[model samples]
Target: MTHLPEPPAAPAAGQARIDDQAAKLLAAVEEAMRTPTSYRDDSPLPDYGPTPPVQQPGAPAMSQQATDVGRAAMFCGLATVPPGLIAIGILVASEHADPTVIGMICAAPAALAVPILAIARLLRSAKPEPEVHQHFHGNVTQTTTHSRTSGVWAKNINQK
Candidate 1:
């Protein structure tokens, strides 16, 4: 059988270029491995002096005295209902008074209770509270990319 001709040898200059390229790739990989990435510090800076008071919603427009007045009215309305009924019963039992007068007196307390409760709720609606705010910032890097801007640049110079 005829022998196959020997394959042509690679030129020394081409081999040198290949070796150089391999060395560069290996150095780049080594640099990527040796220096870890994504080192960052996040620390709170001190606030100067006293922080300005936080702005808030306006004061409750309603007054406490007004509330107390409403409360007093509610208390009176609740208190008077029982006594008015009792009075009506007493008058009816006496057998000398009209039932219509007793009934009118009994209805007054129930009518008054509505406005008193409404006024109390209105007053309670008027009061105010507090508020707060927050913010944050930082830099970050990854291990896979050997970016020249990062510590990996030092290794490239060392290789040279």
Candidate 2:
């Protein structure tokens, strides 16, 4: 390997001499190293601002019969399934299926009843949503608007 004839730091100077610029650069770097940054390791972040207040939603507006039916259906699906499954799991795990068929016979009827009862209640309680149907002839102008809505809503536009 051959070393360059000039010192490693000094190269060919085609334009402005870096000797003056280099001293300024080195002094700036040294000053920056000595100075503290605007950010401190121990400091907490500054607060941006408080958030806007939110309005609470209103209570559910449902008829007594509808509410009761809805609750019953909810109970059967969510409430009954878990407990029923856990009960069957516990009973089977305990290995208490006897020479007599009485244990399974009783549990089978109740377990089967849950789905039947849920289906029956849900079907009976279910109400159909109101519908809109528009029939237009030639040269008709139609406008449609759909939005967030609750409960029953019915409107007839351009009706005689």
**Cα lDDT listed for each candidate:** 0.70, 0.73
lDDT of 1 at 8: 47
TM-score of each candidate? 0.27, 0.21
| Clash number for each model | 1, 0
Off by over 4 Å in 2: 1-56, 78-88, 91-107, 110-160
Provide the lDDT at 144 for model 2: 64
lDDT of 1: 0.70
Worst 10 residues of 2 by lDDT: 37-46
Best candidate according to lDDT: 2
Candidate 1 lDDT trough over 10 residues, lowest sum: 141-150
CA lDDT, candidate 1, residue 115:
97
Which tens-of-lDDT digit does each residue in 1-160 have in candidate 1? 9999965466465365566689999999999999977554456545776654444568655789988998899997898678867886878788757768667766886789999999998898666634534344576543333334445445444331
